[model samples]
Target: MNTVTRPRILVVGAGFAGVECVRRLERKLSPDEADVTLVTPFAYQLYLPLLPQVASGVLTPQSIAVSLRRSKKYRTRIIPGGAIGVDLKSKVCVIRTITDQIVNEPYDYIVLAPGSITRTFDIPGLTEHAFGMKTLAEAAYVRDHVISQLDLADASQDPAERASRLQFVVVGGGYAGTETAACLQRLTHAAVKRYPRLDPGLIKWHLIDIAPKLMPELGEKLGSSAQEILRRRGIEISLGVSIAKAGPEEVTFTDGRVIPTRTLIWTAGVVASPLIATLGAETVKGRLVVAPEMNLPGDDGVFALGDSAAVPDLAKGDDSAMCPPTAQHALRQGKHVADNVIATLRGQARKPYVHKDLGLVVDLGGTDAVSKPLGIELRGLPAQAVARGYHWSALRTNVAKTRVMTNWLLNAVAGDDFVRTGFQARKAARLKDFEYTDAYLTPEQVRAHVEGTARQE
Candidate 1:
C-alpha cells in the first residue's frame, strides 16, 4: 500500500539539512497543517565530523549514524529512495529505490537537500585506481584495507612486495585526506607493535595535494599549524603536486618520480550529485541555483539546500560567493528552510538566508586538534575540547551522544584494536565505482574510462 497522501511536503536527502527541516516542521506546524514525508537513500543521518574517528578504529560506524525513524520525534513518513529525476512541470520526482526499483512521487512542495558525490579530475588512471573517504562503508573499507596491508607486509619475505604494501599514499590536503592520513598513521603504529617481525619505521605515509598548504579553508594561521603538527607525527607532506599516473602496484608523480604502492587514497574534493542534472534547472558549479529565500527561481513551491544548492552568500553582498557544503551551513539552512516552507502555507513572505562563518575545526585523532573558533586560534587540547564539544552538541539524538561518549570513555581505558587482518582484502573502491551511472550518464557517451578495472576485479 502507498504510504503518503497528497498535499505532502517532500524533502530529499536526510543529512544535516533534510533532518533539520523535518524536525523544525514538526515543532512549528500541527499535523492538520500538512503531511510531511522525508525521502532518502539511507535511513540515518551521518555525523560527518566524527567520521575520522571511525576510520581510525576509535569510534565504530554505528556511533556516528542516527537512525531516521528512531531519531524522528515527529509524524513524518520516511521513504527509502533517492530522487534521480524531476518533471518540474508536473511537480513529480522519479526516484530510484535502494533495491534498484523506480518509483514516482508527487509533491505540492519540494525541498532539495540531496548531498554530493566524489568529484573526479582528469588525472590519468584516477577514476578506477583511488579510494575515497566519503561514506560509512567507504570509511570501513579504508580501515579494513589499511590494516590488511600491514598484515600482508609483515608476512611477506619479498622486500619489493613488503615495500609496496607498507607505503600508503593519500591525495588531497583537505580535511578528509589529512584526517585519513593521520588516523591511519596512528592505526599502523599500534598494529605494528604486535608484529615482532615488522619494523614500525618500515611504514611510510605520504599526504599529497595540488595546493601549497593543507586545510587552506581554515585560514592561513590554523592551516599552517595543522600541517606542522601532522609533519611532527612522521607523516611526509607533499605540496603543489598530484599523481600523474596510478596503477595496481605503482603510481607516478607529475614531477617524473614513480613510487610503487598497492594503496592510493583519493580525497581531493566533492561535486554535486548527478541527480541535480536531471532536474532541468539552472545550476552553478553543479549546484541548483536558489533565491535568497531558498526557493527555486521558476517555481515558487520548490526549495533547495545543502551541498546540492548554490545559495548566494547574502552576508557578502551581491558580488559575494555561495554557501559552502560544510555541516554547519547545512544544519542552519535546514532549519531556516523548514520555517520558510511553513511561511508559504500561511501566504507569508519567505525570509532570505543570511549567516556568518562560525570558524572551522579539524580533529587529527588522539587528543590532538586544530581550530579557529570565533576568529581565535586554538590548538592541542584546547582545540580538541572545543571540537568534541561542538560535535557532541550537534548530534540529532541524545542516544547517539551518549553512545559516542561511552565509547570514548571505554576507549581511554582500553587501547586500539590493532589486528590488521582486513587490509589483506583491499577492494580498491574508486570514485566512479559507487556512482549510479546507468541512470545519470549514457553508458558509452560520457566516456570516463574507469581506470584500474583489472586490479579491482
Candidate 2:
C-alpha cells in the first residue's frame, strides 16, 4: 500500500460528471488538501449527444471524443481501465486494465460516475443479431455497415438478398434511437445515389418501439409533428410493437410482421452501470441510491453521481425522484459532487442538488429538427439552429467546438461520403471480445452462464 498524507479521491468514469468533478476539485483543493485520481476505460470524455451525427458521416469521430490529458488542469491522475468491482468496507476498487489485468486501486474517498450500459432483452436471437449505437466504435462501425449494405445490395445478383440488405430496422425511439434512425437515413440516402445499379425506392428505414409515439416524452403535439415528417419520408413508424425474434436474415416483430433485414440497431434504453449495484448500497432502477448531496448514505467517504447514481431531484419538492440520466444532468451533478467533496474536506456545509428541466432537442437529418428550449417549441430550421447551437455550447473545449462546426460546414457543402467500412458487422459474432463485460455479464453471472451453456451444448 502506497502511503500518502493527502486524502485520496478516486473517481470512476470520465463522462461529463466525472470530468466536471475533477476540474472543480483541482481548482479548489491544494496538494495538501486532497489527491484526485480519475479512472476510466477510455482516456477521452465522449460527447455522446453528437454520436448519431458521426455515424451519419455528418461529423468526424474525433469531434465527439474529448481527450482528458490534453487539458492541463489540476494534477489529477488518469487510470486507463474500467472499474469492475469494489470493496466499500476495505475502500479498495478492483479494475480490469485494457490488457485484462485486474489491479487494486485503494483510496480514502471514492466517487462513482461510471455511466450506463445498453439495456438488452431476452428476445430470441436479439443479443447475437442486434447492433447497439452507444459507443464511438459501435457508432462508427454501424455507419460503415449501413453504407456497405447499400453497396452490396446495388451489386448483388439475388433480388431477395439485395432487398434484405436495404431494409434497416432501429429499435427504441428515444433520443439515441430517433437520432440514429434520422442520421443513418441521411447517410443511406446520400450514399445510395452513388450506386446507380440500385433504385432508391428499394431502400427502407423503420423505427419500432412499444410506445404510443416516436418520442413519447416530447409530448403529443410536437411528437405528432415529428411523426408526420417521418411518415412523409416513407420511413415506417411502428408503435406498440417490438422485435419478437431476430435471425441472421430476417426479423419478426410483435405485430407478426416479418422484414428481411441485414441490419438491426438496438438502442432501446440504458440501465445503470452494474458497478453501482455491486457497492452493497441500495439502488433504484439499477442506479445507486445517494443522498441529496450525492453521497452514499451510511458511508462517510463514498459518493456517486452521473448515470449510475440515483440522485434525488430536490427541485421536485423533496420527492424521491432520481434525476434523468442525460448528459445535461450528468455534467451539473459532477460539479456539485466535486463542490460537496471539497466542502466535506474543509468542514463546510454541502449543498443540495437542484436543477430544472431545460427542455429537449431531436435532430432529424438535413435541416429538420424538433426542440423545446426555455419553454418555447420550435421545429424545422429554427429547431435545427437551436439543436446545433445547444450541442456546440455543450462541448467542453473550443478546439472540439470549432472542429465540429467546421465539419458541419464541410458536410453541408460537400455532402456525405457513404463508403462502408464494415468493421463491426464483420465482428458481430464476437462483440463480447471487444465490448466491456458489463454489457452482458457480471463475473459471477458469466461463470454461471458459461457453465449452463456448456452443459446444454
Candidate 3:
C-alpha cells in the first residue's frame, strides 16, 4: 500500500485575513491531511486598528504585532518573505526574501491575502516630504519625528523656524487619519508641558481632508460628534479642502492657504497590494476580483481575500456590490476561506462568505471616543469603553490583550514618557523611505520568471 501525500497549502501575508486563515486550517486539518506554509515579511499579525495608539506612544509596537509562532503546536512552516508575483498557470509564487534572495515556491493551493499599501497621489512634493502612518516603523518614526520637532523648535532662537517646527499638518479625515491626528495632537499637547520654553499655543494641529465630512462612514450624528470632540481638543478640522502641494517647510492647500510646518502626516487611504496586479486577473479598483466563496473564478486552487481581493458582498444582497477592505471583513473572510479550502481538500462542497457590518470605533486618546457598535451611538467615556473593549476582544492572543490592557492602564495613571527613540537621527525617514512600492514584478516579468522556474523544476 502506498501512502498518499498531504496537500501543501501556501498562504501569503500575516495580516488579519492570512493569520486567521492559517489558524483555522491548523485547528481543522490534521497533519496527515495537509501541509501548511505561510509567506510574510514579518512573523506577526499587526493589529492595525491600534496603530494610532502605537504612534501616540500609548502602546508599544510589539504589543500590537501578535506573534505567529506563539504556540509550539502550530504546524505551519513560516517563510519570511514578501510575495512579489504569482503565476496561476504555473502555480508558483515568486517571493523576495528579507535577505535579498529570490525564491519560487510552488503550491497545491494558494491563498493571496497580501494586504494593502499606503494610497498616494502624484502630488509633486508629497512623497518626498510627507510622513506615512501605515507600518510599524512609520508609526515609530512619526512619534520620534514629532518629538524631535519640539526639541528643535525649543532650541532654535528664530521665531519663524520655531513656528514652522511647531505647526503640524495631517492629511485625510478617515479612521486612520482622524485617530492619528487626534492621538498625536494629544502627544504634542502632553509633551509641550515638559518643554517649558516652547509656547503651548504655538503647537497647532491641522487636520485636513478633501471630503465634505470626517469619517462619513460613521454616519451623521457619530461623525459630527467626533469632529466636535477633535475641535474641542484644539485640532483644526479643515473639511472640504486638501493639500495642493507639499514642501519640506510648508504645505499649500487647495483652498489657497499655505501653512508653514515641518511635519506632514499622510494617512489618506490604502490601495490593494501591488502583488494583485502581477496575477493579470480581473480587478475592481486595483483589488483582485474573487467569487463569493473567496476563490478565483475558473481558476482552481487559487483563493484571495483581505485588502487584495474584491470579495462579493452577499450581505448587501447585490450582485455587483463587493465587501469593503476592512479588518472586520478580513477576519471573517479568512476563516471562511480556510473552511472552503478544507472542503475542497476533502471533496466536499464550499460555502459563500456572508457577514454584516459590525460597526466602527474611533479612539481619540484620553477618554475621548465615538463608536457605533450594533447600531447604538456612543460618545465620551462610554464610547471610549466600547472602542477599547472592541479592540481588546479583537486581539488575537491573550498576551497581546494583557499587554495592551496594561498599557492602557499605565497611560491612564502614569502618562507618557514623551521620549524620542532617536530613529530620525540616523536616517531621513520620509514617506518613500518606508514602503517599497517599486519592488514588484510586471505581469510579463512574472510570466518569464514562472517559466524559468518551471524549466528548472
The candidate that achieves the highest TM-score relative to the unseen native structure: 3
> Which wins on TM-score, candidate 1 or candidate 2?
2
Number of the candidate with higher TM-score, 2 or 3? 3
**lDDT per residue (tens digit) for residues 69-167 in model 2:** 777654888888888877776677777777877667889889999888888878888878888877888888888788878877878999999999999
Clashing pairs in 1: 148-423, 148-424
Q: What TM-score, over all chains together, does every model reach?
A: 0.92, 0.94, 0.98
Candidate 3 lDDT tens digits, 1-457: 9988878899999999999999999999988988999999889999999999999999998999999888988889999889999988888899999997989998999999999999999898999999999899999999999999999999999999999999999999999999999999999999999998999999999999989999999999999999999998899999999889999899999999999999999999999999999999999999999988999999759999999999999999999999998999999999999999999989899999999999989999998999999989999999999999999999999999999999999989999888888677665779998778888999899999888877887
Candidate with better TM-score, 1 vs 3 = 3
Provide the global lDDT of candidate 2 against the true structure. 0.84
Candidate 1 local Cα displacement, residue 243, angstroms: 1.5
Q: What is the lDDT of residue 177 in candidate 3?
A: 98
lDDT of 3 at 233: 86
Descending-lDDT candidate ranking: 3, 2, 1
